[model samples]
Target: MSLEIVDSCVGCFACEPLCPNKAISAVMQPGEPLFFINPDKCTECLGDHDLPQCAEICPIEGAIVDEYGEALNPLGSLTGIPLHLLEQMREAECRQ
Candidate 1:
């Protein structure tokens, strides 16, 4: 299945070069904020790697989702911070 970089992406640019099929590219323009994956060109690294290179390298959890809209990199996959902790921090931040 093809992969999609959701709005949660931090635009770290870590996944661009790792793609063997050159499917991933920057979506940056004058005011654009993040990168995007080309579904037409994306193959989920099927023939080139064991897992999708974009998902493997992306540091943001829940940023990269599969065709079915499921996150490929779940909590604790990138950063060591757990989902619960992150949620707590976010809630606290909002209260600030």
Candidate 2:
């Protein structure tokens, strides 16, 4: 299994060099400028590291995901904000 980089990726290149397997790459397709993880080459860093280095280094939440489409770095993970509190803040913003 491999982590897939979604559109949310900002092409920051932070996760590229961190990949232990060299599975991550930059995709230059029009309107699709983002990093991609080669599934064939990806091993989820099982034997390499304790965690997936790409996901651990990614700055954007929900950018890297598992084969099942679950984000490795879900929202509120890197921000240190609880999901429920973040949701409440969003709701408050909408009411304003």
Give the TM-scores of the predictions, in the order they appear.
0.86, 0.79
lDDT measured at residue 69 in model 2 versus the true structure, 0 to 100: 97
Q: lDDT score of model 1?
A: 0.86
- Which whole-number lDDT from 0 to 100 does residue 52 have in model 1? 88
lDDT of 1 by residue, 1-96 (tens): 589999988888899999998988897867665788888999998879998888887888899998899999887777888778988998999999
Per model, how many backbone clashes are there?
A: 0, 0
Q: TM-score: which candidate is best?
A: 1
The candidate 1 region of ten consecutive residues with least summed lDDT is 27-36
Q: Where is model 2 more than 4 Å wrong at Cα?
A: 29-32, 82-96
